[model samples]
Target: MAENLATASYNRRHDLLQRLRTDGRLDVSAIAEEVGISRETLRRDLRKLESQGLLRRSYGVAYPVESGAYESELSARVDSNVEEKMRIATAAISHLGAAQNVFIDEGFTTQLIAQHLPESEHFTVITPSLPIAALHWA
Candidate 1:
């Protein structure tokens, strides 16, 4: 009986992952109903998946985590959305007002923002990313 219960739990979690992959996201209450489980049980399964880095849960929805190995590479991300990222970078810089110091987060878009910042003696840019620091250092 214990073994059967364990198998059932494993099967249910696997099915939940498959559904999240196919649909891109799962509605918590709806999925619980469809899978014949309580919402609490589904929530527990979602939490487990989140802890495993297989999925992320937000509000009442769960989304499968896309493989980050390729997509997260700086070279790949920098080439993917040049125009949109540039526009965002420009907009972000425009809102700086009279700030003498700026903190840029580590990401491709933030890198673009660093590139777009005007050459000014009064501005001091701070970033934790090595690439961004190297770009500005020279």
Candidate 2:
């Protein structure tokens, strides 16, 4: 019985790692449901994976460590947690009180921040990404 349980656990972890690699990120609840396991069980499995440097979990999402040269495309990242990103962006703008210049990084979340920036504010925005620069222009 113990051996069977161990095997089951091993299989679950393997499945999760595989999914994370393919998907780039996994929503915790969605993965738990797909694997037919409780959220708590999945979390435990994720914890093990994190300890092994196989993945990282944040805000109910599991992201795989880059084992190869593979990286998730920006469009895929932009589509994930869009609502949460918008909320974060809205909150982030509040911190820019009376700043004359702002530097935005190259990431989907930063792009949302650029979108949420108040049009009334006359700050000079600087970014290396063309998409973010275009937002300021528009």
Candidate 3:
């Protein structure tokens, strides 16, 4: 039951994020009108999204993070390939093998892959993208 609730909350947040991608802002009344949720509910959802690092909000504004605020250049590139990046990230993780030092390109997509890396699967990654490095450490 808890998992289901989490999933529902996640779905709501994901949908809201996608909307922000296209619209640049999440108006409470508009969100209620479009999503069929009450403004209060949408406000709660937005608050959760803000806390989760999915977005930043103030007063009545929300914008997709850009450049350094988002993924690194490598992560951005990898995100572009979607399936291929996923496959590569998944496969490359197997090569980690307790290695302490790593290198990554200055690409956002590549850096995004590193962000998702497991904490227990320890490795030090060297990357050209500051965002990726921050993501790894974050």
Best by lDDT: 2
lDDT of 2 by residue, 34-133 (tens): 8899999999999998988889889999998966433346875878798999889988999999998999988899998988888888989889988999
Candidate 3 residue-wise lDDT at 20 = 89
Best by TM-score: 1
Better of 2 and 3 by TM-score: 2
Candidate 1 per-residue lDDT, tens place, 109-137, comes to: 99999887888635777889887888755
lDDT of each residue in 24-44, candidate 3, tens digit only = 877767678889888787788
Q: Rate the local accuracy (lDDT) of all candidates.
A: 0.84, 0.87, 0.71
Clashing pairs for predicted structure model 2, backbone only = none
Per-candidate TM equals: 0.53, 0.51, 0.46
List the candidate 3 regions with Cα displacement exceeding 4 Å: 66-138
Candidates 1 and 3, the one with greater TM-score = 1
Better of 2 and 3 by lDDT: 2
